[model samples]
Target: MGQKKRFLLRLDEKLYETVEKWSADELRSVNAQIEYLLTEAVKKAGRWKQEQGQSEKE
Candidate 1:
C-alpha cells in the first residue's frame, strides 16, 4: 500500500463549486474528484508515469 500525504490546496470559488457538483454527480468525494481530474488531465497530456519494464515483465 502507498502512503497518503496531506496538503492544503486553494481553488477559485466558481471552480470549487463546479467541482463540488461534478463530485456529487460522480458519487465521489471532492478530494477524489480533484484527484480524478488531475489524473485524467495528466493522461491526456501524456504526462502520466510508466512503470519500468512493465510491458516486458507482462
Candidate 2:
C-alpha cells in the first residue's frame, strides 16, 4: 500500500453518529468507511482512474 496522508476531520455530531452506525453495519471502521465513500464519489465524478488489471488503490 502507498503511504496515506492523514489529517484531522471535523464532522457534525449527527453526521458522525450516522457514519459510525453505517460503518458498523458494513463491518468497517469509521475511517475506512469515510475513505470508501470518498473513493466511490471520486469514481462517480469520473476523476478516478484504475490501473490496468489492478483494483483501485488508496
Who wins the TM-score comparison? 2
- Best model per lDDT: 2
Model 2, TM vs. native: 0.85
**Structural similarity to truth (TM-score) of each candidate:** 0.79, 0.85
C-alpha displacement of 34 in model 2, angstroms?
A: 0.1
lDDT of 2 by residue, 1-58 (tens): 5689999999999999999999999999999999999989999999988777786653
Q: List the residue pairs that clash in candidate 1.
A: none
In TM-score terms, candidate 1 sits at: 0.79
Q: What local lDDT score does residue 32 receive in model 2, on the 0 to 100 scale?
A: 96
Q: What is the lDDT of candidate 1?
A: 0.86
lDDT of 1 by residue, 1-31 (tens): 1576889999999999999999999999999
lDDT of 2 at 54: 81
Error of 2 at 14 (Å): 0.1
Error of 2 at 41 (Å): 0.2
In model 1, the Cα lDDT at residue 35 comes to: 84
